[model samples]
Structures are given as structure tokens and as C-alpha cells.
Target: MELAVFLLRLLVGILAFPVYLLHFLGFWSNICKKLFPPSMVVFSAIYNHQTSSKKREHFTNLQKFAGPSGKLSLLELGCGTGANFKFYPPGCRVTCVDPNPNFEKFLIKSVAESRHLQFERFVVAPGEDMHQVADGSVDVVVTTTVLCSVKDQEQVIKEVRRVLRPGGAFCFWEHVIAKPSTWTYFWQQVFHPLWFLLFGGCNLTRESWKTIEQAGFSQLQLQHVQTSPILGLVRPHIIGYAVK
Candidate 1:
């Protein structure tokens, strides 16, 4: 009887594996979107620490072509919970824009922790339309892991270009679609429908960098890298700068 029960429990677990994968993949990036407002803090903490090292390097690259840290005006599109706060250079003024209003509390906490940066106003709007920010006024625009999930990649890139100063730079780090040959790539394509449904429209197959390149940026210094993030669909990433 005990052996029979053990086998039955195992069978149930096996049956539910696909559903579990659909909901919990990509370090729970999509799962948190479905979480209750206040409870998102726990998930935010897990995500912040989980990808810290690699993201830190990505953040560091933002300052490379930034020219001068002091007196610089930086804009970050999709600044989710201010995850990149600590990495920003001191003395720079920042403007954060995101559609999720629930992140205000989380951003407040992170802003307090990131003393080096000057806390500019948080704009509640989508990246695709940042009309509140005037044209050619920003020194730098930064984003990390944002492009994969936006409604319109082309519009967002156009907005990024429109707001930057003549010599300003746009820095980004985002996951891209993988090649068709790999096992993870197969799963990324196969389970995409379920993935998007569970993750709030976050698509794993978008060619985000391609859209940016064609956005008429004068120069693009981008590089692609494969990361091991437990979920293959969100592992292959691109990080670099596009100068206007």
C-alpha cells in the first residue's frame, strides 16, 4: 500500500511539471507580475540578489560612454523596483519611468539605500511613450532586461533616441531569442504560448537588438552572451551602447 501511494504521488508531481515550469521560469520574473502588491517585496529581493554580479557588470558598462558622472542627466526606462540604483554613479540626476505603480514603495526603499544617486521624480508611464521627457534633453538612457517585455520595441527605441542629447548614449542589457539548435531554444519556442500567458506578455522570442539597430542609432557597440540562469528561454543576453 505504501509503495502504491508513493508511485501515485510521484505521478502527480510529474504531471504538474509543465505547469510549474510555465509559471516559475526565468527566475520568477513573470511570476512576480502575477503576485500581490505587497508580497512582491520577497520576490524582488530574490531577483535583485540572484542576478546581482552579472547585472552589476552590465550597470558598470552604462558609465563607460557616459562621459562625466557629475551633472549628468540619466533616464531609465522600465526602472523596475530601482534594481539598478546602487550601480548608478553619484552626483548624477536620475529619472525613472515604469508602468507598474506598485513598484513605488520598492523604489523608495532602494532610493534610500542608493545614497550616491540623486533621487529625481518617478514618472508613471510606459517607455514606448515618454512625452513628459522633452527631446534632446537627456545625457544618457539606460535599461536592463526591459526590451524583451515591452509592447512595441520599435517605439521604445525611437523614444530612447528622441530624448537623448546629440551625443548622448543609450545603454541596455536584455535577453534575446536563442538559436534553433539548442535544447533550451527548442523549449523557448515550444512553450512560448504558455510562457507569455503565465508571464504577462513577456515574449522569449523577440529580436530586440535588431529593432534597436534599425532605429537609426549612429553607432552600435553591442555584444551577445549566453548566461546560465536556470531558465534557458531568458539566458542568452545582449549588452552594449547605441549612440545618437
Candidate 2:
């Protein structure tokens, strides 16, 4: 069994050599920036279809957080293709941040289609270093399925806290590692390297919920959910809000 597992992993590494070469030559990032958006659209469609009900359940209460101006300033990190735009409260102003500029066109198209949201602007920056966004400026900070791909989860959480106003909310729904005893966990551990290469740095086994909980949010309401088996290794998710 051990030898079989080792041979399977070796085969995966051999098949992933082209992508590894691209990374070694510093071309993988550019290629991913160009290709990932369109691929993400197809993935998003399937993923959103499976998770929409839970998303609606989590997002419907955002209106209660609106201030006296009756408008919530929302900043979304890693807002790829603006998939969550339709779930936001009507008339809420939304600023988007993403590292890949190639996603801007698709994101703009999504914004145009989402008439309920007021499109603020899109900043090309990673979640870890959103220096363009001001401190304590937004009523809410949101992230969905983003932390697993980020270079620094701790810094990104720190930045999330920095941008949120007093009493503001941080909403998140992210896939996490499966239980240690599961077959899914075994596969996730085995294929993580090849998966990371193919998916542009997304890890299969990040326990991102722990980072969110340790970020010192004044109040947190989080729940672990198991989604469709179609998601395979990434079927377990953590979803909820935390007040800063």
C-alpha cells in the first residue's frame, strides 16, 4: 500500500512537470492571471448552484448593519467575477479587491448584471496588502472561498480587521480541511502539491477557520457545514459573521 501510494504521487508529480516548469520560469503567474478568470466562471456556476441557499441564509441579515445613512460600505477581498454581488443587500456600495487584473472585465460584466449593488471601484491588490483601502472605512468586509489561495492568511485577517469600522461585520464562507480520519483527508494530503500547481496556489487542506477565530473578533457566530460531495476534498466549509 505504501509503495502504491508513493507511485501514485510520483505519477502526479510527473504529470505536473509542465506547470512546475512554468512556475520555475516565472510564467505561471501571468498565465494563471489570464486563464483563471474564465475557468473560475464555470467553477463558480457549479459552486454557487450548490451553495446558494446557504449563502442567502447567511447574507439576508446584512441590512441590519446599515448605518444612519442607510447605505453599507462593503469591501470584498478576492472578489473574483463578483459572484457574491447578487447576494448583497440592495443599494449597498461595494468596493472590490483582487490581485489579478485580468478578472476586471468579467467582474465588470458581473457588476453590470447585478443592478441591486452599487459598484464602487475595483482595486487590483491582494488580500494580504490592501493598502489602497483606508483604515476603519468600511461597514463590512467580506470574503468567500478566498483564504485557501492567499499567501498569508494571518496578514489577510489583520487587513480585514484594519479596514472594518467599529461594530462592523466581517462575513466569510470558506472551505476547510476535512476530518483527519476521512478518506477525503487522505486524498487531500496526497494530491495537495499537484492540486496547488493546477489551481494557482489554492491549498486543499488549509484550516482557515482557526485563523478567523484567533483574529480576536469581539463576537463571532461560525458554523461548520458539509456541502455537496461534488466538491470532493473541499466539501467541508466554515461560514458566518464576526464583529470587529
Candidate 3:
């Protein structure tokens, strides 16, 4: 009886290994969200070098919007885990809006570390509804890899325009819909359904450039880029700034 029980326990351990592994992965993924949102960390590192030039150009353009006070009132939509705190220019008074309250703690700590930035507020609202922000107030509206996942890209763009002061610029770096019939686009569609479930509602096939142009911005400048740093399915990006 003792020998039989030992064999059964060994078999049970073998059978449970995969389940335990999965639980361990899931737990770490959640922990990573608190430490640094996975989407921000993984994708930022992948596109960092490829996006360098465009980020500089767009940030330079946005610097013109700074007021006489020498500060830019920056409103960042989908600001996740304050991953962007390092990229912002000094004297960037930031107002962050995101649906996930889980990011609040990470954001607060980031704000404290960023002496160049002052935290205006953190609104627990999705980009689609930002009634709290007054019209024509902010000097810059920035979004990076954001619209691809927003529930209503159109409404969010409208909100961006409504909140920006006249002449304020909207800076964006986002992956867009790849050319049709390509191997990359094909796989994007194949994985579209599960893409959001795995990686925070990000879609690979959003026509992000067209959506921004139609958002009633007074001036739109975009550069559609093909970068090999990431998988082909997510390597096509549009990076530029639009003026309101």
C-alpha cells in the first residue's frame, strides 16, 4: 500500500507540472503590470532605436507649443505605468488619462522620480471620455501605440482636439495596418481575435494614420515607416505630429 501511494503521488506531480507553470507565468505577468506594464516595456524596447529619429523630430516640433512660462501642458492619453516619463521634456506638466487604476501606483512613483515633470492629475477614465479636461487647454497631446487598442479611435481623436489649445501639436508613434495580402497582414488578422486578450487590447490592423488625418487637425504631417526591429506583423508604423 505504501509503495502504491508513493507511485500515485509521483504521477500526480508530473500531471500538475504544466498547471503550476502556467499559474506561475500568470502571476508574474500581473506582477510585471505593477512594476511596469508589459506592453510599454516590451514594445518600447523593440521599437526604441527605430523610433529614435522620429521621436526627436516630433518632440522638437512640439517644443514650439510651450507657453511663455517655458512649460508645456502635456496631456497623455493611455499613459501606461508612466513608461513615458523619461522621454518627456523638462517642465512638462502632465495630465495622464487611462482606464486602468492598477497603473496609479507605478505612475505616482515615476512622477516622483521625474523631477522634470509635474503631475497635474491622473484621471481614471478611458481616452474616449475625458470630460474632465477643459477645451483648448493643453499645449501638447501625446499618444504612443495607443489608438490601436482604444475602443473608439474616432472619439479619442476628437477628445484630443477638443482638449488641445489652438496651435497645440499632437505627437504620435503607432503601428498601423500593414499592406493587404502581405504575409504580415495575414497573420495579423489570424491573431486579431486573441491579440487584445493577451496584450492589453492592442490591435495590429488599425488604419491609424487615416484616422488621425480625419480628426479635423489643421495640419497633419506623417511618415509611414517600415522597421525590421520587431516582428513583421507589428513593424509597420506611422510616426509624426499633427497641429490643432
Alpha-carbon shift of residue 19 in model 3 (angstroms): 14
Q: What do the candidate models score in CA lDDT, each in turn? A: 0.77, 0.89, 0.78
Candidate whose TM-score is highest:
2
Model 1 poorest 10 in a row by lDDT: 28-37
Error of 1 at 241 (Å): 0.5
Angstrom error at residue 22, model 1: 16
Task: Please report the candidate that would top lDDT against the real structure.
Answer: 2
TM-score (all chains, Cα) for each model = 0.80, 0.95, 0.79
- What clash pairs does model 1 have? none
What tens-digit string does per-residue lDDT give for candidate 2 at 30-139?
A: 88878899999999999889888988888998877776688999999999999898899999999999998989999999998999889999999999899999999999
What C-alpha lDDT, on a 0 to 100 scale, does residue 172 get in candidate 2?
A: 92
Question: lDDT, candidate 2, residue 85?
Answer: 89
Q: Write the residue-wise lDDT of candidate 1 on 21-138 in tens digits.
A: 6555664454556453345456446666767787777766455445443377899998877877877777778999987777788889888988888888899889899999999888
For residue 140, model 1's alpha carbon misses the true position, in angstroms, by 1.2
Candidate 1: segments with Cα more than 4 A from true spot:
1-50, 64-69
Q: What is the C-alpha local distance difference test score of candidate 3?
A: 0.78
**Candidate 1 overall Cα lDDT vs. reference?**
0.77
lDDT of 2: 0.89
TM-score of 3: 0.79
Candidate 2 regions off by >4 Å? 1-5
